[model samples]
Target chain A: MGSRLPTGWRDVQVAARAVRLVLTRPAYATAAVVAAWASLTVFVLSGNIAMVRNLVVSGPLSPGDRLVLVREQYPFLGTNYGTLEGVAVLAVAALAGANLALVAYHLREHELSASEGGGSLVGVVLGVVGAGCAACGSALLVGVASLLGVSGLLLRFPFGGLELSALAVLALVVSTYWIAHGLRGGEVGGCPVDVGGRR
Target chain B: MKQTSRSDRERTAGVDDGRPARRGGREPEGGSRSRRRLLLALGGVSTIAVAGCLGNGGGEADGDEDAGSEGGNEDGGGEGADGETLESHPVGVDLAEKPRLGPDPFDAPATLVVLDDPSCPRCAAYHQGTVAELRESHVAAGELSIVYRPYPVVYDWGERAAHALEATVERDPEAFWPLLGYYFDEQSSFTSDTVLERTASWLTAETDLDAAGIVADAREETFADRIETTLEAGSAAGAGGVTPVSYTFVDGVFQSPINGSASTTAIETALQL
Candidate 1:
């Protein structure tokens, strides 16, 4: 195989194959992209909030105090990394936007199978719910506590909200994967109906 | 594995011919149509759901330019003894311009006020990461001005640090930023008393400001009202009990409060809006 190909042809060949794959299975590709963007955003937001909460609630640290106080100590100076960082962030947002566009494209094409469509709906619902819960903080725990009438049960579990948020994110990821996988079979729709049988 | 295209299936299922074809290994035409409709309906719901999430994140960008300027009025009564707005708590330090960089801070149309606790690692990450980068790009370019508020809302040393900031700003405004730089650069030192003492001395020797005087000022109640006022101002601007809350002002108008140590990209997007 090596001898049959030119030295620079392999990379070009691989890229061509990737492009072909995307063109052939656009729905799956779109689903993967959308799922990734949504899940990543949710994960990052939850993780950041969780880290801040852990810092405040855990350890010997006071809940409402700060560490440093002076401004001169800030090392305030301009660095040359802004453009690069900005580009990176812009790229992520653009990719997310593209994901949304792909979802619309798939819908417009009428190419979604029932299972694929169902998976996508479930995934999107899970993603929204998860993101909301993560923002609410200990919502699941609060509900459980209220239902069981045992508020003290939560004392031993610090970062309960974070844990629940992480779990919800996991579910979102799983649901997204399911949608992508379900789309992999075909875009013509899930179960074929035997219309000829009625004749 | 099914070779049939969607249109072909639809044509076979019901192409205006009343007699429904019984395609082998497939459900009846009626079932096919219902399933297609169900899938389409599901797609519509998913589209709306995902769109809602995206819209929630984007809608704030379109808020009226004057929406948040009045946010300070909610708790405006907690003014400092000087009677100036708490948002104007920055003193001593000449914010007019950063020497060789950018235009005058006061003249800048947009202000990005960040309430950060030096002791908060999240705040540190933001400064060292997003804030530092922002200063390089927007702040230096005169596109934006940053007002730093040392909010102590997570550690005991945090309050001390806030006091020190007030003292530095009140006594030696020029030294305020420098001292803050030192605090963040050597944040670990503030954890222990001995380390903090050494850091104080180091600051005294490093900068033109007297370290002992700054420490003494922290212990005094001179800047107490200002500190409290600043805290209230942050809360009024939607600090929401979190340190590292930031509010952006465009054309001297309050735009929105950025909770936590958000990314530079996120802040930049907000600025654009």
Candidate 2:
């Protein structure tokens, strides 16, 4: 039977089961764990593969590429323009982590509509896995830059000396905050659930 | 009914109570109906995602045409348009075409083999900015031998399939740099078969090349096999297959370039420019 709910709150059940299916399944749960590793593997490989060549060839700068760069590249590099380009990529990774955390958060709150019991420990695990991906993706960006021997390019900026590995750790911390808070939400925030204790 | 278990009835009653809680209205059947709607919506989202991917393939084909046209216009409009340069420190005589090169421009030997689409504007800009510099300095000085693998992969001005690259190669490799410099400079002015052919004619006349013979040769698909071979080799070697791919033999080992014009510095640093 469908979850017991008042009208207009049906999505609560839908999102709850969605979270449950992902969290509770041993195989699906394991896949999430593997995905964390997989993304790391990809990051390592992409960095290594990118490093073999010494030349950075800006491809045919289509007029559009130039325009797009001119428009976004300014705000991107403004103030800290020289160093920000490197971290612009990391910022994107963090944003992705934040978005996934929000989805996990919504799923958790939605499940509460059904009952006090929502995502199990598996929700925490998957949330962490998503967070790991965000952190690792950013880390990989910096590592590849290093392996390519272009780390010196960042030297010109005032604070550009921050290592890519540090960027990765920063991403991980942000991802952890998002994943933990989103999954941990109100229950952990001290919202009293009927019986599920703190999420 | 299993002796009307207390827990089962409690569960059923919970749904029953939830219905009335919805604005104080009592629809005994509301809960079940709402569940069905939610399920239907979920199903619809999946169906749409699958259908969306298929639709995009067709959309990509259309996008390419628009992208090509838009790029050409943007490129042509920018030329000699001083506002766009990041540094006015450039636009010097070194930017123009020359019959020969001296010692200062490029010290080391560097030849760039670019697989380009004539109508693609990105390719045009790269041609104007980097490739032209190489031509004026390296090729003219006989320090580096440049090769043109005009990969007409994208739609060249909407007609004359493969007409663009083949014409450039067959027309005259010697004059290809100057011709390409001109073609890239004025991409927006010509986007059709007639315009392309007329431009080709003008290039031959301008360079005093054998224009009619080159155009006639291209029509026979003379450079067809060479184009295919080069594109295949490039793909095998991990090229993105987009316009403006450069396979540079820096010290005689072929390698791809890093992404961006700023690579100009990296390149100069690499080659001690």
Candidate 3:
């Protein structure tokens, strides 16, 4: 009963084990992949949703052409910002998928209220708002800023709004840990101490 | 001291087995309430932080909206007098040198000056959607004219495409629109290293233009100055930062600037059509 693990080590272990359990199931794995794909699409198309809609509605581009265009227009891919932005998009997508999967697992296993899944909702909303090209700005970010009465402040970000995406990734990671902690039979309201005498 | 597992303690404490321990179904309310409050505080703080990050602490204090609109008028120099109609605003770019679609500028009831980058996804969408719709509904009907100002804002490949566009405009003005269309159509296939070769080959196969000369001029950056001038003009017109921005002028009076992707309805309303 005297085992002293480092801070956050237990959370990480629990999260890893939970993720393994979730991914091993074919249904959960498929859900994760679908979620990841959807998240990636939203990130890539955040600012261009209207344009893409117009394209589909009245534009002359075929579906295949639209797909190609989207692939090439991924934020910072051909820009001077290097590949870090692309990596950020991928990381956000992956974390968002994992968060959703873990939340789903928690809900299935426990009879918790909807508030228990609030972290997952927060992570998703943050990811969508933060998804955009750091250099050119995403329409979602711009629209949100405009609503907040700060139309042009995104241009002043030193890292070109990458911080928003970073924050979103952090939120998703915490949400994942929270879900994992719950799945490991740890009380969410209490310190995640191992008391099962198993390890 | 006797050792008791967490599960055993929960059982002895009369916690419901079906309910999660965190829910505190029969436990004291303080811990659960505190945790919920903590999560709420964290969420509130994060929301505020996100808003702050995006808003950059300035909000409306910076007067960016007013300044941007003022700057746009000053840049375009197209501010019309009361009840006056002009052919076009003195946006500094030579309108005659640009590729045109539909009626002559003087003959059309409305003019749409488009600033776009070929490599821009939004621009591609605009080209495929609003542009195509307008070409059919307005341009072909002889009610509207479109002036293209290719301004590269996405990547270096866009600049190269601009050069090729200029070369095409120089040699065979009629081929300019198709070449621009081709670039938009196959945008993903061309990279900075491959745009020149691809454009040249496509031109040779698709049209009767001098593909080699166009490719050579693009490689030599023959139209760099022209492209830069158009870029400056677009910047001056307040469409610099974003691609696929359009300026609409109806009956020679500056109507509005459609930033980002211009929908057909917005353009139609601007055109008073």
Instruction: Report the number of clashing residue pairs per model.
Output: 38, 8, 3
Tens digit per residue, CA lDDT, model 1, B57-119: 222222222123312211111111222222453321233322112444455665666777766
lDDT of 1: 0.44
What lDDT is reached at residue A183 by model 2? 36
Among all candidates shown, the one with the greatest TM-score: 3
At residue A21, candidate 3 shows an lDDT of 70
Give lDDT: candidate 2, residue A59: 31
Off by over 4 Å in 2: A1-199, B1-108, B133-145, B156-171, B188-192, B255-262, B269-273
Cα lDDT tens digits, model 3, B158-255, are 88999999999999888988888898888778889999999988999999888999999999999888888886666444443456666666776655
TM-score of chain A of 3: 0.78
Chain B TM per candidate, please? 0.61, 0.51, 0.71
The docking category that best describes candidate 2 is: incorrect
Q: Candidate 2 clashing pairs?
A: A55-B258, A56-B258, A57-B257, A57-B258, A57-B259, A58-B260, A62-B122, A77-A81
lDDT of 1 by residue, A1-199 (tens): 3321223544334323322343345664666566556544442333222222222223223333212111101112111112322233223333333333333433443243443334334444444433332332222233233335653554224442334334433333333332222233223322223233222
Give TM-scores for every candidate, taking all chains together and pairing residue i with residue i.
0.46, 0.40, 0.53
Pull out the clashing pairs in model 3: A47-A139, A59-B128, A59-B129
True contacts kept of 3: 0.01
Sorting all predicted structures by TM-score, with the top scorer first, yields 3, 1, 2
